[model samples]
Target: MEYLSNWAKNIVYYILFVKLISHLIPSGNMSKYIKLFTGVILIIVVMEPILSLPNMEQKIKSNILNMENIIAHKDFQSQSKTYSKVNDQLAINLYKKQVEEHIRKLVRGEDVEVSSINIKINEEEGKNFGEVVSIDMKVRKKNSSNDLSIEKIKIGADSTAYNITAEDIIIVKNIKIALRGFYNISPDNMNISVSQ
Candidate 1:
Protein backbone atom coordinates (compact mmCIF):
# COMPACT_ATOMS: atom_id res chain seq x y z
CA MET A 1 0.00 0.00 0.00
CA GLU A 2 2.90 2.44 0.86
CA TYR A 3 4.57 1.69 -2.50
CA LEU A 4 1.30 2.41 -4.28
CA SER A 5 0.92 5.72 -2.40
CA ASN A 6 4.49 6.79 -3.34
CA TRP A 7 3.83 5.99 -6.97
CA ALA A 8 0.67 8.12 -6.89
CA LYS A 9 2.56 11.08 -5.33
CA ASN A 10 5.26 10.96 -8.05
CA ILE A 11 2.66 10.98 -10.81
CA VAL A 12 0.83 13.92 -9.25
CA TYR A 13 4.11 15.95 -8.93
CA TYR A 14 5.01 15.25 -12.57
CA ILE A 15 1.61 16.41 -13.77
CA LEU A 16 1.94 19.73 -11.80
CA PHE A 17 5.43 20.34 -13.21
CA VAL A 18 4.19 19.89 -16.75
CA LYS A 19 1.26 22.22 -16.14
CA LEU A 20 3.55 24.95 -14.73
CA ILE A 21 5.96 24.72 -17.65
CA SER A 22 3.21 24.89 -20.22
CA HIS A 23 1.65 27.94 -18.57
CA LEU A 24 5.04 29.73 -18.51
CA ILE A 25 5.51 29.23 -22.29
CA PRO A 26 3.78 31.39 -24.90
CA SER A 27 0.62 29.73 -26.09
CA GLY A 28 0.62 30.67 -29.81
CA ASN A 29 2.46 32.51 -32.58
CA MET A 30 -0.07 35.38 -32.32
CA SER A 31 0.66 35.86 -28.62
CA LYS A 32 4.42 35.99 -29.19
CA TYR A 33 4.03 38.48 -32.06
CA ILE A 34 1.69 40.59 -29.92
CA LYS A 35 4.31 40.79 -27.16
CA LEU A 36 6.96 41.96 -29.65
CA PHE A 37 4.65 44.62 -31.06
CA THR A 38 3.69 45.82 -27.60
CA GLY A 39 7.38 46.14 -26.61
CA VAL A 40 8.12 48.27 -29.71
CA ILE A 41 5.09 50.45 -29.08
CA LEU A 42 6.07 50.96 -25.46
CA ILE A 43 9.59 52.03 -26.48
CA ILE A 44 8.32 54.58 -29.00
CA VAL A 45 5.72 55.91 -26.61
CA VAL A 46 8.32 56.49 -23.90
CA MET A 47 10.93 58.10 -26.18
CA GLU A 48 8.74 60.43 -28.26
CA PRO A 49 8.04 63.15 -25.68
CA ILE A 50 11.57 63.07 -24.31
CA LEU A 51 13.07 63.41 -27.76
CA SER A 52 10.66 66.24 -28.72
CA LEU A 53 11.68 68.62 -25.93
CA PRO A 54 12.49 72.13 -27.12
CA ASN A 55 15.79 72.19 -29.02
CA MET A 56 18.72 74.63 -28.72
CA GLU A 57 17.63 76.46 -31.87
CA GLN A 58 15.05 78.44 -29.92
CA LYS A 59 15.86 82.16 -29.49
CA ILE A 60 16.07 83.70 -26.02
CA LYS A 61 14.93 87.28 -26.36
CA SER A 62 15.61 89.38 -23.27
CA ASN A 63 13.69 92.62 -23.09
CA ILE A 64 15.98 95.24 -21.65
CA LEU A 65 13.09 97.13 -20.10
CA ASN A 66 11.83 94.07 -18.26
CA MET A 67 15.22 92.80 -17.05
CA GLU A 68 16.89 96.18 -16.60
CA ASN A 69 17.06 95.94 -12.84
CA ILE A 70 17.88 92.27 -12.27
CA ILE A 71 20.31 91.99 -15.16
CA ALA A 72 21.87 95.38 -14.49
CA HIS A 73 22.60 94.87 -10.83
CA LYS A 74 24.64 92.01 -9.39
CA ASP A 75 23.22 90.01 -6.51
CA PHE A 76 25.17 90.58 -3.28
CA GLN A 77 24.77 91.80 0.30
CA SER A 78 23.76 95.43 0.71
CA GLN A 79 23.10 97.75 3.60
CA SER A 80 19.44 97.95 4.62
CA LYS A 81 18.85 101.51 3.45
CA THR A 82 20.75 100.98 0.17
CA TYR A 83 19.00 97.69 -0.40
CA SER A 84 15.59 99.34 -0.01
CA LYS A 85 16.46 101.94 -2.61
CA VAL A 86 17.57 99.51 -5.29
CA ASN A 87 15.73 96.32 -4.38
CA ASP A 88 12.37 96.10 -6.12
CA GLN A 89 10.69 92.89 -5.00
CA LEU A 90 8.24 92.93 -7.87
CA ALA A 91 10.91 93.74 -10.46
CA ILE A 92 13.19 91.10 -9.00
CA ASN A 93 10.56 88.37 -9.30
CA LEU A 94 9.50 89.48 -12.75
CA TYR A 95 13.07 89.61 -14.08
CA LYS A 96 13.91 86.29 -12.46
CA LYS A 97 10.99 84.62 -14.18
CA GLN A 98 11.82 86.34 -17.45
CA VAL A 99 15.39 85.13 -17.24
CA GLU A 100 14.22 81.56 -16.94
CA GLU A 101 11.71 82.00 -19.74
CA HIS A 102 14.33 83.62 -21.91
CA ILE A 103 16.65 80.68 -21.34
CA ARG A 104 13.93 78.27 -22.34
CA LYS A 105 13.20 80.28 -25.42
CA LEU A 106 16.88 80.32 -26.37
CA VAL A 107 17.21 76.55 -25.85
CA ARG A 108 14.36 76.20 -28.28
CA GLY A 109 15.98 78.60 -30.72
CA GLU A 110 19.54 79.63 -31.63
CA ASP A 111 20.51 83.11 -30.47
CA VAL A 112 19.43 85.70 -27.92
CA GLU A 113 18.78 89.33 -28.83
CA VAL A 114 19.57 91.80 -26.09
CA SER A 115 18.37 95.41 -26.31
CA SER A 116 19.66 97.54 -23.40
CA ILE A 117 19.65 97.77 -19.59
CA ASN A 118 20.69 100.14 -16.76
CA ILE A 119 21.05 99.82 -12.95
CA LYS A 120 21.81 102.18 -10.04
CA ILE A 121 22.16 101.72 -6.28
CA ASN A 122 22.72 104.08 -3.34
CA GLU A 123 25.74 102.84 -1.48
CA GLU A 124 25.14 105.19 1.43
CA GLU A 125 21.69 103.74 2.12
CA GLY A 126 20.67 100.21 3.17
CA LYS A 127 23.59 100.04 5.58
CA ASN A 128 21.95 97.25 7.49
CA PHE A 129 21.65 95.18 4.36
CA GLY A 130 25.34 94.35 4.82
CA GLU A 131 27.14 93.57 1.56
CA VAL A 132 25.57 94.49 -1.74
CA VAL A 133 22.83 92.07 -2.73
CA SER A 134 23.22 93.11 -6.35
CA ILE A 135 25.54 95.12 -8.56
CA ASP A 136 24.72 97.40 -11.46
CA MET A 137 25.47 96.80 -15.17
CA LYS A 138 24.96 98.95 -18.22
CA VAL A 139 23.95 97.47 -21.56
CA ARG A 140 23.41 99.00 -24.98
CA LYS A 141 22.40 97.72 -28.40
CA LYS A 142 22.21 98.95 -31.98
CA ASN A 143 19.78 97.92 -34.67
CA SER A 144 21.35 96.25 -37.65
CA SER A 145 20.99 93.27 -39.99
CA ASN A 146 24.49 91.97 -39.38
CA ASP A 147 25.57 90.08 -36.26
CA LEU A 148 26.63 92.22 -33.27
CA SER A 149 30.20 92.39 -31.95
CA ILE A 150 30.19 90.88 -28.46
CA GLU A 151 33.99 90.95 -28.18
CA LYS A 152 33.93 94.73 -28.24
CA ILE A 153 31.49 94.89 -25.35
CA LYS A 154 32.00 94.11 -21.67
CA ILE A 155 30.20 91.97 -19.09
CA GLY A 156 30.41 91.90 -15.30
CA ALA A 157 28.84 89.37 -12.96
CA ASP A 158 29.24 88.99 -9.22
CA SER A 159 27.52 86.80 -6.64
CA THR A 160 28.70 87.96 -3.22
CA ALA A 161 26.28 85.59 -1.54
CA TYR A 162 28.20 82.71 -3.07
CA ASN A 163 31.59 84.42 -2.55
CA ILE A 164 32.00 84.87 -6.30
CA THR A 165 33.25 88.31 -7.22
CA ALA A 166 34.20 89.43 -10.71
CA GLU A 167 35.87 92.80 -11.09
CA ASP A 168 37.12 92.61 -14.68
CA ILE A 169 34.54 92.91 -17.40
CA ILE A 170 35.14 90.98 -20.65
CA ILE A 171 33.93 91.53 -24.18
CA VAL A 172 31.60 88.56 -24.38
CA LYS A 173 29.08 90.46 -26.44
CA ASN A 174 31.24 90.30 -29.58
CA ILE A 175 31.73 86.57 -29.17
CA LYS A 176 28.01 86.18 -28.76
CA ILE A 177 27.48 88.04 -32.00
CA ALA A 178 29.97 85.81 -33.81
CA LEU A 179 27.99 82.79 -32.69
CA ARG A 180 24.79 84.25 -34.03
CA GLY A 181 23.69 80.96 -35.49
CA PHE A 182 24.47 79.15 -32.24
CA TYR A 183 22.80 79.39 -28.84
CA ASN A 184 24.39 82.45 -27.20
CA ILE A 185 23.77 84.79 -24.25
CA SER A 186 25.45 88.15 -23.45
CA PRO A 187 23.96 90.02 -20.50
CA ASP A 188 25.96 93.21 -19.74
CA ASN A 189 29.32 94.60 -18.56
CA MET A 190 29.57 95.86 -14.99
CA ASN A 191 31.80 95.89 -11.90
CA ILE A 192 31.36 96.69 -8.19
CA SER A 193 33.02 99.83 -6.95
CA VAL A 194 32.39 103.02 -5.00
CA SER A 195 29.81 105.25 -6.61
CA GLN A 196 31.41 108.55 -7.59
Candidate 2:
Protein backbone atom coordinates (compact mmCIF):
# COMPACT_ATOMS: atom_id res chain seq x y z
CA MET A 1 0.00 0.00 0.00
CA GLU A 2 2.77 2.40 0.92
CA TYR A 3 4.65 1.60 -2.28
CA LEU A 4 1.54 2.17 -4.39
CA SER A 5 0.76 5.45 -2.63
CA ASN A 6 4.36 6.67 -3.15
CA TRP A 7 4.21 5.68 -6.80
CA ALA A 8 0.96 7.58 -7.32
CA LYS A 9 2.30 10.70 -5.58
CA ASN A 10 5.46 10.76 -7.70
CA ILE A 11 3.50 10.31 -10.93
CA VAL A 12 1.13 13.14 -10.05
CA TYR A 13 3.99 15.50 -9.13
CA TYR A 14 5.77 14.78 -12.38
CA ILE A 15 2.65 15.31 -14.46
CA LEU A 16 1.86 18.62 -12.79
CA PHE A 17 5.44 19.85 -13.13
CA VAL A 18 5.52 19.02 -16.82
CA LYS A 19 2.23 20.75 -17.41
CA LEU A 20 3.41 23.81 -15.46
CA ILE A 21 6.64 24.10 -17.48
CA SER A 22 4.86 23.61 -20.79
CA HIS A 23 2.39 26.35 -19.89
CA LEU A 24 5.13 28.77 -18.66
CA ILE A 25 7.18 28.37 -21.88
CA PRO A 26 4.25 29.08 -24.26
CA SER A 27 1.35 31.53 -24.88
CA GLY A 28 2.59 34.74 -23.16
CA ASN A 29 2.99 33.52 -19.55
CA MET A 30 0.11 35.10 -17.46
CA SER A 31 -3.16 33.74 -18.88
CA LYS A 32 -1.63 30.35 -19.75
CA TYR A 33 -0.02 30.09 -16.32
CA ILE A 34 -3.34 30.67 -14.52
CA LYS A 35 -5.31 28.30 -16.71
CA LEU A 36 -2.66 25.54 -16.66
CA PHE A 37 -2.16 25.78 -12.90
CA THR A 38 -5.89 25.61 -12.21
CA GLY A 39 -6.37 22.74 -14.64
CA VAL A 40 -3.38 20.84 -13.31
CA ILE A 41 -4.53 21.22 -9.68
CA LEU A 42 -8.05 20.04 -10.50
CA ILE A 43 -6.70 17.08 -12.48
CA ILE A 44 -4.40 16.08 -9.65
CA VAL A 45 -7.15 16.46 -7.09
CA VAL A 46 -9.56 14.26 -9.03
CA MET A 47 -7.12 11.74 -10.49
CA GLU A 48 -5.17 11.06 -7.33
CA PRO A 49 -8.22 9.51 -5.69
CA ILE A 50 -9.16 7.72 -8.91
CA LEU A 51 -5.67 6.25 -9.12
CA SER A 52 -5.74 5.11 -5.49
CA LEU A 53 -9.28 3.70 -5.65
CA PRO A 54 -8.61 0.32 -7.27
CA ASN A 55 -6.88 -1.19 -4.27
CA MET A 56 -9.54 0.04 -1.82
CA GLU A 57 -12.34 -1.18 -4.09
CA GLN A 58 -10.73 -4.61 -4.44
CA LYS A 59 -10.55 -5.01 -0.66
CA ILE A 60 -14.17 -3.91 -0.21
CA LYS A 61 -15.43 -6.26 -2.93
CA SER A 62 -13.51 -9.17 -1.45
CA ASN A 63 -14.89 -8.53 2.04
CA ILE A 64 -18.48 -8.18 0.78
CA LEU A 65 -18.25 -11.40 -1.21
CA ASN A 66 -16.88 -13.22 1.82
CA MET A 67 -19.73 -11.89 3.95
CA GLU A 68 -22.30 -12.99 1.37
CA ASN A 69 -20.82 -16.45 1.20
CA ILE A 70 -20.88 -16.74 4.98
CA ILE A 71 -24.52 -15.67 5.12
CA ALA A 72 -25.48 -18.11 2.38
CA HIS A 73 -23.63 -20.94 4.10
CA LYS A 74 -25.53 -20.10 7.28
CA ASP A 75 -28.81 -20.23 5.29
CA PHE A 76 -29.87 -16.67 6.07
CA GLN A 77 -32.14 -14.87 3.65
CA SER A 78 -34.98 -12.30 3.78
CA GLN A 79 -37.16 -10.78 1.09
CA SER A 80 -36.37 -7.13 0.22
CA LYS A 81 -39.61 -5.64 1.60
CA THR A 82 -39.46 -7.77 4.73
CA TYR A 83 -35.86 -6.75 5.31
CA SER A 84 -36.76 -3.06 5.00
CA LYS A 85 -39.71 -3.33 7.38
CA VAL A 86 -37.58 -5.22 9.87
CA ASN A 87 -34.86 -2.59 9.57
CA ASP A 88 -37.31 0.26 10.23
CA GLN A 89 -38.70 -1.42 13.35
CA LEU A 90 -35.20 -2.17 14.56
CA ALA A 91 -34.24 1.49 14.14
CA ILE A 92 -37.24 2.63 16.21
CA ASN A 93 -36.57 0.07 18.94
CA LEU A 94 -32.93 1.11 19.19
CA TYR A 95 -33.95 4.73 19.65
CA LYS A 96 -36.38 3.81 22.44
CA LYS A 97 -33.82 1.69 24.27
CA GLN A 98 -31.24 4.47 24.13
CA VAL A 99 -33.70 7.05 25.39
CA GLU A 100 -34.68 4.82 28.29
CA GLU A 101 -31.08 4.25 29.26
CA HIS A 102 -30.18 7.94 29.03
CA ILE A 103 -33.19 9.05 31.08
CA ARG A 104 -32.47 6.44 33.73
CA LYS A 105 -28.98 7.82 34.10
CA LEU A 106 -30.01 11.49 34.14
CA VAL A 107 -33.01 11.36 36.47
CA ARG A 108 -32.37 10.95 40.20
CA GLY A 109 -34.51 7.99 41.16
CA GLU A 110 -34.26 4.33 42.12
CA ASP A 111 -37.24 2.66 40.46
CA VAL A 112 -36.91 4.78 37.31
CA GLU A 113 -39.91 3.53 35.40
CA VAL A 114 -40.44 5.28 32.10
CA SER A 115 -43.99 5.73 30.83
CA SER A 116 -44.96 5.69 27.15
CA ILE A 117 -42.20 6.50 24.65
CA ASN A 118 -43.17 7.54 21.15
CA ILE A 119 -40.90 7.72 18.10
CA LYS A 120 -41.82 9.51 14.90
CA ILE A 121 -39.84 9.41 11.64
CA ASN A 122 -39.94 13.01 10.31
CA GLU A 123 -38.49 13.15 6.79
CA GLU A 124 -40.75 15.94 5.54
CA GLU A 125 -40.45 19.77 5.64
CA GLY A 126 -36.68 19.66 5.90
CA LYS A 127 -33.42 19.18 4.00
CA ASN A 128 -32.44 15.99 5.83
CA PHE A 129 -31.75 13.95 2.69
CA GLY A 130 -29.69 10.76 2.51
CA GLU A 131 -28.26 11.53 5.92
CA VAL A 132 -29.29 10.72 9.47
CA VAL A 133 -32.85 9.73 10.37
CA SER A 134 -34.30 12.26 12.80
CA ILE A 135 -36.37 10.71 15.60
CA ASP A 136 -38.71 12.69 17.87
CA MET A 137 -39.76 11.14 21.18
CA LYS A 138 -42.38 12.00 23.79
CA VAL A 139 -41.27 10.42 27.09
CA ARG A 140 -42.63 10.30 30.67
CA LYS A 141 -40.57 9.42 33.74
CA LYS A 142 -41.74 8.97 37.33
CA ASN A 143 -39.77 9.56 40.54
CA SER A 144 -40.90 6.09 41.55
CA SER A 145 -40.95 6.58 45.37
CA ASN A 146 -42.73 9.95 45.51
CA ASP A 147 -44.65 9.48 42.26
CA LEU A 148 -43.84 13.07 41.25
CA SER A 149 -43.91 14.04 37.63
CA ILE A 150 -40.42 14.52 36.21
CA GLU A 151 -41.99 16.86 33.66
CA LYS A 152 -42.70 15.10 30.42
CA ILE A 153 -39.50 15.22 28.35
CA LYS A 154 -39.51 15.79 24.63
CA ILE A 155 -36.23 14.80 23.00
CA GLY A 156 -34.86 13.73 19.64
CA ALA A 157 -32.34 11.08 18.70
CA ASP A 158 -30.62 11.11 15.32
CA SER A 159 -29.53 7.77 13.93
CA THR A 160 -28.60 5.96 10.72
CA ALA A 161 -28.28 2.25 9.99
CA TYR A 162 -24.91 1.01 8.88
CA ASN A 163 -23.85 -2.62 9.54
CA ILE A 164 -27.28 -4.11 10.18
CA THR A 165 -27.59 -7.40 12.04
CA ALA A 166 -30.40 -9.97 12.16
CA GLU A 167 -31.59 -9.12 15.68
CA ASP A 168 -30.42 -5.54 16.40
CA ILE A 169 -30.26 -3.98 12.94
CA ILE A 170 -30.00 -0.23 13.61
CA ILE A 171 -26.82 1.75 14.29
CA VAL A 172 -26.67 5.09 16.11
CA LYS A 173 -25.50 8.11 14.13
CA ASN A 174 -25.87 10.88 16.75
CA ILE A 175 -28.15 11.94 19.58
CA LYS A 176 -28.51 15.59 20.52
CA ILE A 177 -30.35 17.71 23.08
CA ALA A 178 -33.38 18.99 21.20
CA LEU A 179 -35.96 20.36 23.70
CA ARG A 180 -36.74 20.03 27.42
CA GLY A 181 -40.07 21.13 28.94
CA PHE A 182 -43.53 20.18 30.29
CA TYR A 183 -45.33 21.97 27.48
CA ASN A 184 -45.85 18.64 25.74
CA ILE A 185 -47.74 17.21 28.76
CA SER A 186 -50.89 19.15 29.70
CA PRO A 187 -54.41 19.50 28.37
CA ASP A 188 -54.28 23.30 28.81
CA ASN A 189 -50.47 23.45 28.47
CA MET A 190 -49.24 25.13 31.66
CA ASN A 191 -45.67 26.49 31.92
CA ILE A 192 -42.88 24.62 33.70
CA SER A 193 -39.23 25.43 34.49
CA VAL A 194 -36.45 23.41 32.79
CA SER A 195 -33.10 23.31 34.57
CA GLN A 196 -29.68 22.53 33.12
**RMSD in order of candidates:** 28.4, 26.8
Each candidate's lDDT (Cα)?
A: 0.40, 0.46
**Candidate 1 global lDDT:** 0.40
Listed in order, each prediction's TM-score against the native is: 0.18, 0.25
After TM-score superposition, the amount by which residue 136's alpha carbon in candidate 2 deviates from its true location, in angstroms, is 60
Query: How well does candidate 1 score on lDDT at residue 3?
Result: 44
The list of candidate 2 runs beyond 4 A from truth reads 19-38, 51-58, 74-196
Q: Mark the regions of model 1 whose C-alpha exceeds 4 Å error after superposition.
A: 1-27, 55-196
lDDT of the structure predicted as candidate 2:
0.46
User: Could you tell me how far off, in angstroms, the CA of residue 88 lies in candidate 2 after the best superposition?
Assistant: 38
Cα miss at 192, model 2 (Å)?
Answer: 74
